[model samples]
Target: MDLAQVKKLMLRHDGCVALKANTWSESTFTALQPLPVEQRGAYCVLKTVELVYLLCSVHPLPI
Candidate 1:
């Protein structure tokens, strides 16, 4: 998804704010390498992937 769509989805679910915080931390630290310049939305993408994995693991399928 594009950055705008990612932002909208995060805002809808309260994840946007946390993402902003993570971005800020990367900016403020000198030793910490900022997320790849190319992967501006990588964190959000990874988080969404993780959430999907968690849900699938915990939820049972209907027989």
Candidate 2:
């Protein structure tokens, strides 16, 4: 999906935001600064299929 579509989906989900981070970048951790404490919970991780499903649900495209 495109960045615009991804941003739209993220906005629709409450208290959730998406950040594009390189796996080896220290900025990845620094970029988490804006996320609210309550939303941060224990950790931030998601399964690949789960993420794909969410994106598809939000913006289904023609096959």
Candidate 3:
């Protein structure tokens, strides 16, 4: 899958999910299945001893 495929799929889903609870746990995660390796997003849910979540998209960035 490519960004075009991802963006196409997002069009089916409402572009974003409602930010329910604003928290993540041992069970909650976002998994875009049946996708090719290229269309995947980056994740950094853990940083050493801390848990960090972002409301950001990674297809493009200043970095």
Candidate 2 deviant stretches above 4 angstroms: 15-63
Residues 1-63, candidate 1: write the lDDT tens digits.
Answer: 245544555567677333333433454343234667666466657655654443344341121
Checking candidate 2 for backbone clashes, the offending pairs are: none
Order by lDDT, highest first? 2, 1, 3
User: Can you write out model 3's per-residue Cα lDDT over 1-63, one digit (the tens) per residue?
Assistant: 245644554566678434345334323344435445565443332421132113233432121
| Error at 37, model 2, angstroms | 26
Best by TM-score: 1
lDDT of 2 by residue, 32-58 (tens): 568788655432453333344555565
Instruction: State how far residue 24 of model 2 sits from its true place (Å).
Output: 25
After superposing candidate 3, which stretches have Cα over 4 Å from the reference? 17-63
Which 10 consecutive positions of candidate 2 have the poorest summed lDDT? 41-50
- Cα RMSD of all models vs. native, in order, equals 10.3, 11.9, 14.6
Model 1's alpha-carbon lDDT is 0.47
lDDT of each: 0.47, 0.50, 0.38
Question: What TM-score does candidate 3 get on C-alpha atoms?
Answer: 0.27
